[model samples]
Target: MDAKTIYAQSSDIKSRTYLEYRKDMKKKAIAELEILVWLKSKLSTLYPKQKIKVSKSSGDAFLWFLRKGGVTREPDYHAMIDDKDFDIEFQYADKIDLKYFDFAISKIAKKNKKTGKREPHQDRKILYILKNNHSFAFFNPEWVLKNGKIGFVDAWRKDAYRIPRNKFIKILESDPTLKSVIEMIDVKNYILNFQHDPIGINKEKLSFLLQQIIDEQKIIKIIPNDLDSFFKVCFILDNLNKAPQNINLWLVYLLSFISNKNTTEDLSKIIYCVDFLYSKTELKYNELKSLVNKVKECFKLLKSFEQKDGSFKSSVNLSPIDETRNAVFSINLLEDLTQDLIFYYKTKEFNPITKIYQNLNFIHNTYNLIKNLSMHYYIS
Candidate 1:
């Protein structure tokens, strides 16, 4: 849809327009493309002898959200070195979460419509570009199955193999050819010069920002439209090793922000802010009571939006991914906070986070239906 159309549809959300969201998406698309082009050129330059070819693969779901979004898509590009096929995924993440990688691999493994052949099997060589650090790794579902053990990943709210980063690094380093590629991929120092500084308040200004946000008198003056500034303040506070004092007032400000008018974006941010606050310190007495009540209230509201299939309703009704993703985050945080025994009596109904598993099951079932239909069509 056009910018104005998207914006009109998504006006219910916080200050950010769908046009701005699309613009951000476009910027990410361009940045990733630029990185891909640069990586291809660098690889070609570094190994003139080796038959290095990095071409854009059709599998990458760069902006499928803007398209007819229903199911999710994995982003992938192809690389052929000495005729050895490897599927490369470039992503921006602070740390490696193997469940997502596993899910992406599952998505990548698709059946050919006419031929009924499973393309890009799990055994296919997979490499990752951790964009945050500009580091590279060898990670595939085959490798994960063989090497890693199952454990719960809190972020994904699913069990993933608890593989060490060192193991992935070892694979990248063990092979002489792969090691050479890794060496060439070490563009951190080279890329840092061109990188823009992260946008947020600096460490020095954090204390001052906190004082302003938690300041009971002035904090109420901040209109809902100006909550982005409050977000920046929360960002700084969340990063701090020590918990901010006078958190009760901070929470009151957060709770006040919650209203029926608040959109999914607003709700998710407030949920995250609450989660971040609870994580930093031990709350007791009225502080604990206030926090627990807020969580329960939020959970009730979240349940109102929950679909029978586990996906949450979106105001825009454009994409399930947009609202469902935020809902997942909120649920995860709620699930985490309610883990304590003190919260059990109050939030017993909301325990275990079965919706997350249900959501995964829903997605998988959809995939299976599509696969089976394709197979039946091909056979007929």
Candidate 2:
């Protein structure tokens, strides 16, 4: 009953409580105000019909089209006016929808693995009129699916609004500034124009987040689907800031693909270990990226076997290996790649960031000491 173990137990309890609260809350009301701001403006030209019908959020045909595309939020309005029918979905980024973009791309899992039967029929949504806070953006299903990436300026803020059929091109022509924003957008500071900027990624914030994870022994308590404490801290910090940078954002993005009980421990150690390896070879960053790709594949393989139960299992071609070991290995590989990228800007170059990276020498030493503990799992 060590302190770390105790922390892990209580943290797990808290997580369960939080998850319960999360499930209890569902979107019962549509974001009508946001939707109306766009839809009412278009009624004159789009639908010339005499019949006007507006109903509350209903997960129905055409309405369900959103559901098929992975959008679970009920559309604010499913309306029929002069026999013209349409659905409008409103989204406020940095608020209700973290993965809201996913809803615009693919159809939900079409067939069940065990039954191999087609799922229920749902509407196929093509164009989505979206509001990103005060401003609005258009979503094109075909373009998103073809590209497999969402551009930040795809949803507009600080730009003029238009209901153009070719949203991307129209946006480009309508607002050059938004075009510039899209060109410049990265993983952080994307679609959501954050309201505040208290902290941006640097070594100090990274250290604070990592320490939170280590102190709480989050690595020791990770569940199959739960996010790591270090990563969770990143999200919390990110939510506070309006425009977050790529450093911590990229860290969590790459780290999240793999999961394990020791994910936190492995990542904590690997961050430093990678730095050491980088110093020896001094390889270029692009070369490091290529190496990290291999690690991602390994994680993909390990993640594939995650079962209905929490435990990892063997697939036909894959061996049944320990999930934690593979996760640690993946973490090590990513750490080796990320060491230099994280510290790209100098401490004096950016205030407070350097402080976080400072005073963390013990993490490297701790990794060295407990490196052999992994051997126990190896032997067993």
Candidate 3:
């Protein structure tokens, strides 16, 4: 189905119906629960006779089990615990905010120190369950408190894991067929390790990963695969101190490669790079101005090709060809130009050639004249 038809169909669905459907789908989705159960089962199976115990501390009633005194049983069962069995308590709530749990865990770890043991007594075993229907265990207090507190902690074990809502929804919404595709991606360890330590993904590694994925031609073929990897790469890029030169180049390349696949929001993200560059102090005005000019030219070309209203044809490529994708690309280019023009007016930079005050009035007048007209249709 085309975008318009899909959008219309979605609009026809009642909001409450859609929401209830999502809720029901989540309940039936065994992927998350399976992950939790698998982890618990693995630990027990690893040392079946070693007095290992598992418990579901979260709101989920199916898998909450507690292990104590070499016995494992349902958390509600009081038979699994004894005062001498290193009394560990399992608490489950609607949502387990890690920040609060870390604080509580830290207090417990400090108070339960063993004199003869190399590590703190509480450090030997600690676990918590969170709202996301996952369980996390801490073996060493030192490791748990590595970065001082859970909230302040960096990547756990240098692994990044989280079911980011935006990316997840984008994937499902973009390709309804990819529900299973997303499920296949391993996220259990990522979540488990993330709870203990935040993932420490650097720009270079992220860039390399993105390039590798793109080179494999996997992303372009499968929307789910590309969207997942693309967002992950973008997330890492978004958090960086600055977009690395190599990463920025890669992004530009990706943008060009996907020009034919332009969406309004996708184009917006690409335009965001322009705004980011303009906002930075690192790049000189002259450098930015030159880049902006090039973008402006691109926008002019795109404006020429755009049909009436906002939509463009999909045949346009990044080349000089008259295509709709090029036109959409121009929309972002124009957005950046407007931003720069506003900036220049605010800063009052003297025009080297015109020798006049670069005030808001002049900028507004120029923008008004050039703004609405299509770049191709407008004859200068």
Candidate 4:
């Protein structure tokens, strides 16, 4: 079946239950205020001569200032320690998208109101406070960009680097200025005492919930697999009588196993799994090489499927709507991976100039189709 038919059939399907649960989980992991309070007290002592001020910074005027500097998303808090400006953000996840670092480094050329000439925006340091297990870890964007390993993050749908908890611990323990602050506060005890939402649901309850979602949303035939294989895997996992440590990561693997073939969806699943594993484990050179090789293979396959008309031919026959949607999704994923390779990894195999022209042509054709062709069908 084509993407359009499947989407049309499942258009009314609801995912509110699962979405609500995720929303609740996010709200309960509140750490921004506590972290800011601690930083204010500790930093004042660390730098006695320097002035320190920190506060929530999402007022209209501040947001306007950030927009002028080319930032769309507002950081949770702004801190001024001595003369240095810092944008502080707290995240419940161990990893952060590399794009944030890119944004930090990029200086937008904005016209100066007084001089009427383009001038570079002032740079501010980004401080990320990430949650790991029961504690928090601090990440300096500059340090991370220099030493961090970038990988595809499934949650954010972008390539990111992990902010390991141990690194922060080491900094607190070894750094002379920070060592005193560690003595002044009980970091571990404070974090452990922080209120957390308990997982009241057991394996049986979780299985029941999963089954309900599968039925209600009619998500039985998720991507990279058909109905039979999807159900088979679900049944096998259900019989195990044990919940997978990472439910989403397990599903990615389950879907890959069911497919037993390479497709654009399979490529995405591979990247997702790789991202999950890399976050938990140390970076291995051999594994990284293997992942790059797989990326090259997928790139070659996608290029083969590209048609002369700037549209990609789907592996299975699809209607114009379905094909266009699928092709656009595949192209977006391909472009993301290609940029990661060219910019971060510095791979010479791919030509950026050639891709630039190809993407421009694809964009032009898509724009024409949406403008001229779709206009004919408009009701008003």
The root-mean-square deviation over C-alpha atoms between each candidate and the true structure, in angstroms, is 20.9, 22.4, 23.6, 21.0
- How high is the CA lDDT of each candidate model? 0.48, 0.33, 0.33, 0.40
Compared with the true structure, model 4 gives a TM-score of 0.32
Model 1 TM-score on a 0 to 1 scale: 0.35
lDDT of 3 by residue, 1-380 (tens): 11111011111212223222322322322233433443445445534655544433322222211111122222221112222223233322234333333334332344335563322334133333333333333233444344333233253333222323332222111223223322322222222222111122323344444322122122222222243344443333334322334443343443442343454334434454443433332334655455545454444444444444433444434322223333333342344345344444332231121101111123232232233343544554
Model 4 lDDT per residue over 151-208, tens place: 5566657656543444444432223343332322233222222211111222233344
lDDT of 1 by residue, 1-380 (tens): 11111111111112323223433443344344545655576567546878887755542213212421232344446777787766665544344543343334243355679998545455345545554344555455556556665566776687654556656545432223333333323322222211111112133343333332233233323322345555544554344322345665666667777666665666777876776555455556677667667777777677777766645675874345445556655654455455432333343333432121222324433333334544565697
Give me the overall lDDT of model 3: 0.33
Candidate 4 clash figure, as a count? 0
How would the candidate models be sorted by TM-score, starting from the highest?
A: 1, 4, 2, 3
What are the clashing pairs of model 1? none
The CA-based lDDT of model 1 is what?
Answer: 0.48
How many residue pairs clash in each candidate at the backbone level? Answer: 0, 7, 14, 0
Q: Which segments of candidate 3 are over 4 A away from where they belong?
A: 1-235, 239-242, 245-270, 314-333, 344-380
